[model samples]
Target: MFPLEHIAIRQAAYYHPEKVVHNDYYLDHFKSRGKDIARFLQVMGREQRYIAAEGENALTMGYQAARKVLSDAGLASEDLDMIVFSSQTPEYTYPTNALLLHHRLRGKSRTITLDSNANCAGMVAAVEQASRYMQSNPHVRYALVVGSDLSSVNCNPEDEITLPNFGDAAAAVILERRAERPGFIDSLYYTDSDDCENIMFPACGLSNIYNPEMTPEQIRISWKPFDGTCVVEPAAADIEEVMRRNGLTLDDIAAFCLSQFSLKNIELICEKLGADMDKFIYVGDEFGYTGTSSPFIALQRGIEQGSIKRGDYIFFWSVGAGWQLPTVLFQY
Candidate 1:
């Protein structure tokens, strides 16, 4: 592990499509298709979401956002020492998204390419990893952090279960070392592998085990209606423990950037902590359930939209597939 002295988040960017899907359509279909679908969505507090129009994969979306980060940081592709792409949804199972991004970057071979599949806790985890990498490799000057997800493809549109809420988006952040002061303060990570079954894609990747008699189409149908309860209690308790470990109270946190799973869960976490709800950043209203892009998207949007101020102590909390809980503390 590298010891991080100082690191700053240079800039962040994201790509969200403008296409809109109406809630009424889902409501009507769910009434006849699966009532639990409608109820689940309603409680999730997602009215609509953005989806890639066409020919938009995670790699492309990530490229679009990563280019913005490069431009914003005023650094050329040659400056990056490492590219850490965080996403469970890769363009292909063979070549990782990091390699695809490297291609888009026009052959930056000097950079060590890697990918993280931590879903919700990805950004925080990436930040931690990048910081450690920079700390160890003193010669490495910069690292590119990408959190992208195109969840709409897995969304069961006709099933009316999780269609309206699933959206696709990508966010990229540049990490660089600083002399006087840096951005990230302290990060806390926790994982409960036992609760991995609480949330998942149901059918995709290795989970889609081949049945001896079932056809691919039948397997696909079995994977549809990917609906599961996004339990936050265990995650909430973990976050609280992290905060306590840092010897900081909820009031010490200027802003809360949480994994945007649902509106109800957001409220539940805030209420349990008795924290100010207004301090929490909300991206679900526009971006929807972006599996891994939630934190970075919120950070970029929160800063751009004036939701966060300079020198604000931002608290990031994320929970994902492994039921992993990772909390991060930063100042910007």
Candidate 2:
């Protein structure tokens, strides 16, 4: 066989603010609104989540995580050939969050930097995009992909869907090209935007950000509840397809790093796929739904906990808002 370019994960780390918000914290508040906070927590399988402290946001969280990953890998800013920041809760709309991060890291002038927002599935998309970009450019070797979100700040205070469920966290991964065995294999994507309007940040739209009449409530996240089950079938299909096309089987995968959106959904997908729950890595209960960083957080924690190891096959899957699914089949 002819030789081919390859890219694979080098290291990954995640960061969360110091504060922890448990289900009990939302009990009285959500109960007063006639909502079943207990059932909600039980159904979601969430115990507690990390919340940004007084001075934290996406940028800060992401930077900390990135620094940790780089430190662990013994890589300096100049070592990276590209930097990609993925988030919907970006700290700045202009100047590009990725570029800002690059500036903070004192990245080399030759490094390519950019920001992307594909909602929750962002990091998955970013990694795939970065891998493809690096594969085509022989000059680019190491790349940084960070996914962070301060969703708690964007959430509506009175909204049960956003306020009580969402949390803040950031995850960073270092990808490097290899010449040997397996690395990034192939990716599959499918989109279903029928419920596109259900979840939205900047409810009033960016154009109205400066409008004098726009109230605080209007600028916060707008979360209209929908059947989250929309993700299950598609997720299962995509996972199977990626494995099929790659000539891999369920037995070949060492772990499944799925979106931390809902534990119930993950359980259902496992049931549908007849896959063992032991192979699935989930950290949503403690971290909550961290938007774009969800899967990466799962990946990092999985590795740290010894659920995955070097040269093992890994499957990654996540769903974005307006609903986009990006599935990746990789060898760690």
Candidate 3:
């Protein structure tokens, strides 16, 4: 159990692109493919999603979100001790997105920056890392944690299962050291690499790197094919373990901010855990599954809608592409 009493979440913010794609767009796109667009929408509980404009990418959205959180906290880029940017849809394989964001945000040279490719679980994993840093380093006053992804760019429009499920977004939060109260209560992470291929981009990794003959066209065609059903059992087990380890029941949690994979999946998980469906924030209908940014965006939206409040015991959970599951229980 990794718990931090000194680190506190100072602020949280998110950014979505201006371009929007309605369910009608998917309905038309999948008509010839024999996909039941109406049934898909009803099952997934998704209506529309925001897509990135021509120039917008992960870094740009993340930078905007980071700036918003920092500005709201009344701090400049120079005041940050570290920046942790998490995403699978990076602009480039090299020159990590975190460093690029640090440069774009005009952070000081001394500020440490790095990236985590934890997929959907990136946000909670980042918070765990940032909280640990603040706990160990007395001089580190503030750290910026960002989870941003443009999953639309990695999706194949022809694949009905993968196409309408994703939307582009970025979310950021500022973590500061405060000696007054507990911040992170405990966090548990579980992964099963055997199921990694269940959700993956087949052409973007070492296989393409080793095979120089692979062209850009091959890479572009290699979109992620996901099996949404594969996550249900693992998520249920992980959530159970987290609760057992922390000695808490479903009723003890005030709010549950989970990955915006789909409303059906969220409801299934809630049923498996015997959790109240009303306590879980549902944002996929409006935002689609924003990949790593889902949980943070949901948390922000819940707070905005007066559903979540301070001193409440909040549970943050997500299952990522690598079959990674990270569950965090904390007091807000």
Clash statistics: count for each candidate: 0, 0, 0
Please give the TM-score that candidate 1 achieves against the real structure: 0.88
Considering TM-score, which of the candidate structures 2 and 3 is the better prediction for this target? 2
Candidate 3 residue 331 C-alpha distance from true site, Å: 0.9
Write model 1 residue lDDT over 80-150, tens digit each, in one string: 88898988777776677888898889746788888888866786788777877786687667899888888
Which pairs clash in the backbone of model 2? Answer: none
Give stretches of model 1 more than 4 Å off: 1-4, 32-38, 158-161, 198-231
lDDT of each: 0.75, 0.89, 0.83
Top candidate when judged by TM-score against the true structure: 2
Which segments of candidate 3 are over 4 A away from where they belong? 1-5, 202-217, 221-227
Q: Tens digit of lDDT per residue, candidate 2, span 1-332?
A: 21447898989999998899988888878888887778777777788899999889899999999999999999999999999999999999889899999998999999999999999999999999999898888888899999999999788778877787888999999998778756898899999878899877799999998999998889999888888888899889989988888888888889999988888999999998889999999898998889899898999898989989999999889989898999988899
Write the residue-wise lDDT of candidate 3 on 100-205 in tens digits: 9898899998888889888788888888878877788777788999999887876766778767878899999988877665467778788878756655564566
Which candidate leads in lDDT? 2
